[model samples]
Target: MKTYTYRHPEAIEHTGEVPVMDEQGQVILYSQRVYENYLKRTFDKMFDFRYFLKYEVLDSQREMLFTVKKISRRGKLWFEAVEVASKKKYIISYENWRIGLPTLFITDRKLKIQLEKEFEDWSNFLLDEVEIAKWKAEFSEELGEFHMTLQIHENSPIQQPEFFVGICQATLFVGA
Candidate 1:
């Protein structure tokens, strides 16, 4: 299995670029700044308080793979990943968390697990990280398994993707 690290570049103007790196520290995919106007920034800070933003995930060739948008509605975080070519959207929204286990809804699927600890920093209400695993039944002929893990370096000091992580992860899971 190959490891992927999400990295944020060091600089004021370049901080918006979040790169997904391979084990060799090479960027495989990256998030591009879609819109960051002065009015949007000021408005978000003034009213929404950083509750909405948009970005694009591009491959190494800079072709758009997905358009990611995160918005807060009625105190719930809604993250959507839209495939550029197909326009298929995968959405994940925060549900009523129970006993420190976050309830996340991906369409009709509800995922409530402690493995999502790393993503807890995205909001103060979350308490765990997110990990994905694939399982197959020995007797089944039509089961597909898709597993992905994100590995970050200790020294890179990158900001967590927040709801963007769910958008990327859910897209990979549901889209694949």
Candidate 2:
């Protein structure tokens, strides 16, 4: 098994680059938040919170790996994961209002994403019933850092860093 980490950018500004690290604490991938429009950015500032955010993940070679976007559906937020090269979407997650938990929908694969603790909390989740990738959020901290032990499935097609990033952000930073 391998470990990876994601450190949120400095909060001096509302937006910055997030670094994805390997077990050795070396940067392997990076993510950046994107807004759909100036109006959305304005709303985020005016409300003093973020509602919708799109993250683009890039590898060390500067190759785009995936793009993940968080959107509002009904009364909850949902995530969309898209691969860069093939433009393929694999999985999407939406909240279960009855349990107040998020459930994943495997769009194009016969895989599953289950919460690590099974609805105890929203902070941690599993990739495929196993704890391959887990997120630990630190939103109230000084740097707003969120840590994770990410191990992308070697055989799964949904091995995008942005996918987990979106999941982590949705778990920690929900304002809508």
Which window of 10 residues has the lowest lDDT sum in candidate 2?
Answer: 115-124
Task: Tell me the lDDT of model 2 at 9.
Answer: 45
Q: Superposing all C-alpha atoms, what RMSD in Å does each candidate have to the true structure?
A: 13.2, 3.9
lDDT tens digits by residue: candidate 2, 1-176: 45577766434224566778877888888777767788888787775555666667778776778777766767665667777788777556554634544455535465676644232223444555555555554444555544444556554445555666655544444323
Error of model 2, residue 160, in angstroms:
4.6
lDDT of 1 by residue, 19-133 (tens): 6666787877876545567777667555433344566777778777777766656755666756677766657555444234345544413333222322323221121343332
Deviation (Å) of 169 in candidate 1? 9.3
Error of 2 at 115 (Å): 3.2
Model 2 TM-score relative to the real fold: 0.71
Q: Spell out the clash pairs found in candidate 2.
A: none
> Candidate 1: lDDT over CA atoms?
0.45
- For residue 145, model 1's alpha carbon misses the true position, in angstroms, by 32
Runs with alpha carbons beyond 4 Å of true place in candidate 2: 9-13, 73-76, 97-106, 116-128, 138-144, 151-162
